[model samples]
Target chain A: MEMLMNPSQMTKKYFTPGVMLVSLIALNGLIFLALRLIFGVGAITNLDNQHPWGIWIGIDVAAGVALAAGGFTTAALGHIMHREEYEVVIRPALLTALLGYTFVALSVAIDLGRWYSIWHPLIFWNGNSVLFEVGICVMIYVSVLYIEFLPIVTKKFIGNVRFKGMLAKLNSPVDKLLRMLDRGLDKTMFIFIIAGVVLSCLHQSSLGTLMVIAGPKMHPLWQTPILPLLFLISAICVGFPMVIMESLIASRSFKLKPEMHVLSKLGSYIGPMLGIYLAFKVIDILIREAFVYLMVLSTESVMFSIEIIFGIILPMRLFFSKVVRESPLGIFIASMLVILGVVLNRLNNFIVAYNPPYATTSYFPSIGEISVTLGFVCIEVLMYRLIVKYFPIISIPEKAGVFKTKYSIQGSK
Target chain B: MATQGRRDFLKSLSAIGISTIGVAGITPSITKASPENILSKDRMGVLVDTTVCIGCRKCEWACKNAHDMPSGSIDDYENESVFDNKRRPDYSALTVVNKYQNDKTGSPINVKVQCMHCDQPACVSACIVGAFSKKENGSVVWDESKCIGCRYCMVACPFQIPSFDYHKALEPEIRKCDFCFDRTAEGKLPACIEICPVEAITYGRREDLVQVAQEKIKNYPERYNNHILGETEVGGTSWMYMAGVDFKNLDFPTLGDKSAPGVSESIQHGIFSYFVPPVALYALLGGVMWISKNRDKKEEN
Candidate 1:
């Protein structure tokens, strides 16, 4: 038996024009964020009584959560399925989910009118509220994501702990702490992995349930009792594709060979997963008699069509082809479609479907709102780049023994 | 007096005993906030007679005064020019009277708009932090300290009554008609009901108010629409309306008889019901993981 692969930090130039551009966008967002904090949500948002949520909830929290399903999906595949081939991609996926959820939480805090009172949901119980369920689940899941990510921290710094001057005295203690923590986590990691998958399922579905209470305020097309089911299925469908998309991008960005073998295999799984999602969607439409809505060609109908046709169906069809699954560009485009489709679905659910009675004007996100969302995204990219460059997230064959001691290193796969 | 006092004390003791038993009986719904037996029979409500309203907007003035939002003199509300555009309750005003044309007579109909204060308030059921509560007196009052200002209440509300103070970056409250809970608690009418010049708004026990609304419509079929706006809308609101025109013409949403939170709460309970589904899911995943890992190991061996 031989070690198939190992995870190692990428050695690359830390800064580039692209990084600078992302930092600028993040800074632009920070400016608006300061204005939002100093002035109010009203100052930078188009949200009013009729539209209490806008792009922040749609794109940042809901879409962000759905896209981050990669973490749990990859973890389940690698560790639970014992598919060692997927082990190389797991750390990157884990890092992405960790940062993805962190931003979801950060955006939620920013979007709250009383951001300071964000901790209120912890102590005050509201069992009837879907939002309450969502809040609690997301909070716990975020913590779980961090715990799932703790191994990376320990792996990166265990034997490598170093410091300057008088602080060097703390190095041995820190190293001892890391080693103990790593050992404890190694035994307990399975529990967190299972918990992570379960938590993701709970909150991803609960996000759709958040809008079910809106009742008649939501357009009939998107409003259904099976909303939570749809959300969960869609989240699951998007998981592997997100992994494929990110892995390809990371490979390209880091100038390393894409692990097409594992990804192509993952790609093969996407077709059937997507088919399940599309079947549920079509069955839902048929059961609800929602196809009549398609005939009208309104914005809702059009958006729904785009979501199904381009987002789910087309990508799904593309994935079935052995060529598409095997090609980098084809899989990337297919993955991008699924990602965009999920984003559109969330936006439609949160924004487009809502139609408050007596709304004098329809709501749109202000420039400030758009800027802030873009800023958070840029910051996320910058953080991801910084993390992989410095930490053992991307897989390489050298330095395998730093974390896992039993790699034998005898033969090749 | 001593003997009478003794009898009174026993009555009080029995009352406490009965209430505790009742509370124990319905504790689950209370904790879950569907509150089956908790809506008091004597819960106060308002019956708004839109046909009788003159659009004087005096109630609006009184509401602002009572809420201690900024206010103008009573004379300022008399301007008919404001009715050219429709109005809704916003941060500046807790209630507003909007005028609509009567198709039958071509005369203007004045409709007073505010919180319906439903028997089962969507706001109370939707608040992420349990900030909003449906009081025994039928007012859906929110505690400021508990509110994280998530604004899900605005989305949940059937009438879209909740408004926010978006201008204030700090402590932006979800402002709406509180049914004048403070005033009603002091054995006084809601400020708007008290100041309604035409007596268009009548405040009484919800049970009595429904009866009165029914009688009014029955006696003057020509004057009122056959339907009572809030009697069955979103599971009966504390503030019901008897409009001459269909409520839809007055910008009232046509909602079903089911409480707004019914489907949502059912789903929430289904998913988290005593944590059965989640536990089962965990066990199922654990099983799959075990089988898969064992299969992999057996293959290698």
Candidate 2:
């Protein structure tokens, strides 16, 4: 597979854009450093005591993690369901997941009041905090992801017979041990899969639970005990659509074959999840008797309606249509809308709808905050590109061995 | 060989089943016991008689002075020109007195806003790093050292009382009224209670505070509203309020008896109490794996 993708051709297509993206990322980082050194968070962020979290927590961390749920969801569908068709899309989903989690971690670091004490969670265990659960789960999951990607790393680096022989001798026992480990991982992968699903459920809901505790401070439109359920379902709803969007974008950007069948099948899962989410959302408002507030058509209500229509209803309609689902551009646009809806939902919950009676201040993200966030995203994409370029993430066909045999004979001649 | 495989499968199945049942049984009891045993005792609290308060910012000023917080100008409080506007507790100001204009009565009612010091405070429950805790004497105290500065407490607080010093580079503690826990511990009233020229703030045991609030309501029927604001709101707040007007006029959140902390904690503990769901999921996966493995074996043959 590596030999087939002529290096010169790959470089000509990818090198310039990759360099430009990296330069933009560096420029963002430089601006962030200036903000950190001179102005402090007060100068650069819209955060106040009343709105301590703002976009960093809402959009970057919470919504970002929810979008990244594609990784586990796709992995589970592919491996657990034995859908070999999904195998082609799994690595890209994993890459997105890795980058999304990385961005979340970065957002957390930026949002912390005492940024230096970030390692306190690992050092001291706070058993009661929902945040403690989030921290531990995210940290462990990040490590688990890297381990999951280790096969790609190893396949990229070790090549020569002498080196391979040395590694083989050293790793033969370890390879057997790893294969045994892989068997154990395969057998118990369901536990981790279920745990990941459950943990994501807990934390995503806890994100809403975090605001539910705000009680009256949280806008009535966003507050409910059922918030956790809404968040969990919404995260799952956004997850597959994000996978579709990411796959389409990455494939086009990398000039790789599009996995349309897998994405279309994923759309089937997404369509129903969005329906269930909207039903619960409407039912929740009705139960809370908050529909009266929507009738007034306030700025908040209009925003809420826009979020629902564009985010859920529009994309959902597109997903159900077979013609649209088959189109790469249509799926990409729907995926973007789903992401937009998730982002807006989180923003409304965390910032827009939080009504601290005494403090009526509205927040807008500072340029520095935006820069840091964008820098993290750029770094994430760069790492994904590098990994995919070097590693055999996309599995080659068994028949490719025949091509390799023929190519070797031609090279000798 | 078939019998042996069946026996092994059954043994695996039973192991999974028994462990799941055991986990399900143990989880609820564990969750119930943990929070119950950790319940704070001798919680110190305040009883505020809104009938007595003159909308004076003395308590607000005294709180800042006692805590060594940055002082807002005295004119900021006294000038009626600025007083009509509602004030919120912020990083600098741990307490605020706001006027609630009642349309029915055609009178302006004053309510001093501060931490409710809920018996089961959501801020305490929400703090995964244990930055916030209910003191035995009833104040919801914050430890800056334990704080990861996540400000989940700010988001968790029902009263919107907890304020984060987001501007500070280091040691940004959540600023809120502690019911003058440090002063109260030394056998003195909180600074707010001490300096209230109108004697609006009363500090005592939570039980006594509720009793005082109820007595005031009972004794002065015309002077006070029928309800004590915190007696049952959010599972009984430590701070009770006796207001001249309805509490809702003052923007007090209409809360139910169940504490927010209890609701979230119950769900957290309920879903994650034991390894039941994971084990069950694993068994289901294992069963699928087994069938697939056998099918592959047959295909090879």
Candidate 3:
């Protein structure tokens, strides 16, 4: 194991001042207060009966969950696939998943009308409802995520002799029992991993299935039985690219070593997934006989075309190209495009493309809604930074010379 | 070597067995509706003659009054310029009359839009909460009390009929025409049929309605189109239409015979029915995990 950074250096470099963090938290709190007090959803939001869900459901929840898919995808690749090189990025991806899911839970709390009655779904089972399936699955998966993160938390908290001794006395036979439980959990980790994958698949598809019930209210260009499948496939495609984006951003910001090798390897999976996704997307449109609608250059059609080109086709091309896949900057740009694509696809399905002929209302998220979303994102980033700082998250460390030289140069400057 | 091979075979068999077990646990019980139940031969419905409609908005008024809904004044319809553009059902309005210009008639056709009340109502099937249900007499009704307000019925209604009361704070209802299920239960015609001045909207047993529609087309070949709208669309609606011109000219969607619920529910059940894929996925992951764990153990030894 590499030597730890001295406490002073760690504190100076890693931890942002508490005041700045608190101010960010306060800003979010103020937004929450405004949402609760000043506005019913209509006062602040453009949502109507036509567009029931908006940016909160589409981007903040759906896209957020898809981005979090990186956790299971990476863990499955590293631990299950036994690609040990990818193991370095696993914990960060897990951290991302944890934060992403927490944000989804928060989004649900904000969006639900009877927010207090949220527990009813947990207590009462509506087996037939797709939302019920999604709600239950997401709730369970979030718990599973934190359980997966337990070892990292324990390793960080239970440090040397003093902490170990304190824990040891309390541990007793229960300690041995707990260790056995951990081993059993590790052995059965595949069950939860598979369960997570299954649940994610079910809920992600159900997210699109939620729109399937919208009938003629949904623009014909997007309304089809195949939407659920498209959503599931797109989620998997988005997962790898999101991981790349998150890792690259973290590496650049923290002056950590880049994981270009793993990212480029991930490009191989993403390229083909995008290809399969685009192929099926075209087939779905054709089969539904919705291709004719695309011929008319209406606003909906134009937006649809732009979404396909910019979100799917362009990103796929960039990802597939060897030169672009290998370059750090190229991969980063492609990852951004992929992320943008997923967001646009979800937003188009949920908001922009939802047309109720009786009620021709448009939605732009209120400032409060936008602030809450941003605040949730900030919280996610803060949690990630804190976890990585305290826990042995990423396996590859910054070269000693590189770290020293950078700090010395910064001091001199 | 022989024992090792036997053990590997056993492992593979157990993996497959585990997957099948998992799938069996979650698969929905397939209780197919009897063919008699499936086919609604005696299904009753209404046939609206759009050419005869006077744009009186009487149906709208009668439906609201009968259902005890809040009435909108003439100004509400006029200010919205509802006639200028085709209007659909709203949270407050269960039905609407829209003026459609037909080149064949060289005049306007006032088409009243409401729930088609499909023979196989997608809204009924798509509703997991049992909020929307089809009655024995053929009317599809919604029980708002059971609704968790998930709005699946809104999405499932091919006619775009179900409208939600999104503005309401406490208890918002999903508003749509129930084919006047309550009035029909009392052996009375729907409020719209009772109040229609022109007799443009006729309510009866759907079979009788179809005959009535055909007889009108046969009697006035010039006035009515031979085609009976909703006779086969989305596997037949409880409500049908007879138009002077082609239905498409009036902005009616030319949907296929396959019901929306049939397509979606089939896919839902097909993927989820057997629980096979998830089980298979688990077995694959488990096998891989076991192999890796064993390899690690060997290395340690």
Best-fitting candidate, scored by DockQ: 2
Tens-place lDDT digits, model 2, residues A1-413? 22221111122244666668686886786578567645556667877766677777878888888888887777666545545456556666776787788778878876777777788887555455667767877887776665555444433333422336547676456555555554444333344443454455556666666666577677778778888789888988888888888777666776666778678888888888899999999999999998888889777888888888999999889888888888888888888999899989988887788776546767778777777777777777776666666654543323243222110001111
How much is B197 displaced in model 3, in angstroms? 4.3
Interface RMSD of each: 14.9, 7.4, 9.0
Fraction of real interface contacts that model 2 preserves = 0.47
Which scores greater on TM-score, model 1 or model 3?
A: 1
Candidate 2, residues B82-139: lDDT per residue as tens digits?
Answer: 4667777777888888877766566776788888888878887777676677777777
Candidate 1 lDDT by residue in tens digits, B1-301: 1112334433543453455456445536546555555798888888888888888989989999999987888998889999999988898888888999888888899988888888888998899988888888988888999999889999999889999999899999998888888988898888988888789899988899889989988899988889988899888898888887888888888889999899998898888766667766776776676667567657768
CAPRI class of candidate 3:
incorrect
lDDT of each: 0.84, 0.71, 0.71
Q: Among these predicted structures, which one has the highest lDDT?
A: 1
Worst 10 residues of 3 chain B by lDDT: B27-36
In candidate 1, which residue ranges exceed 4 Å CA deviation?
A1-3, A397-413, B1-32
Candidate 3 off by > 4 Å = A1-39, A112-133, A154-184, A206-226, A279-305, A312-327, A352-372, A386-413, B1-43, B72-86, B100-108, B128-130, B183-189, B291-301
- Can you write out model 3's per-residue Cα lDDT over A83-168, one digit (the tens) per residue? 55565566678778888999898777666543445566654443445666678779988988877776544433332323255576
Each candidate's TM vs. the true structure?
0.93, 0.84, 0.81
Candidate with top TM-score is: 1
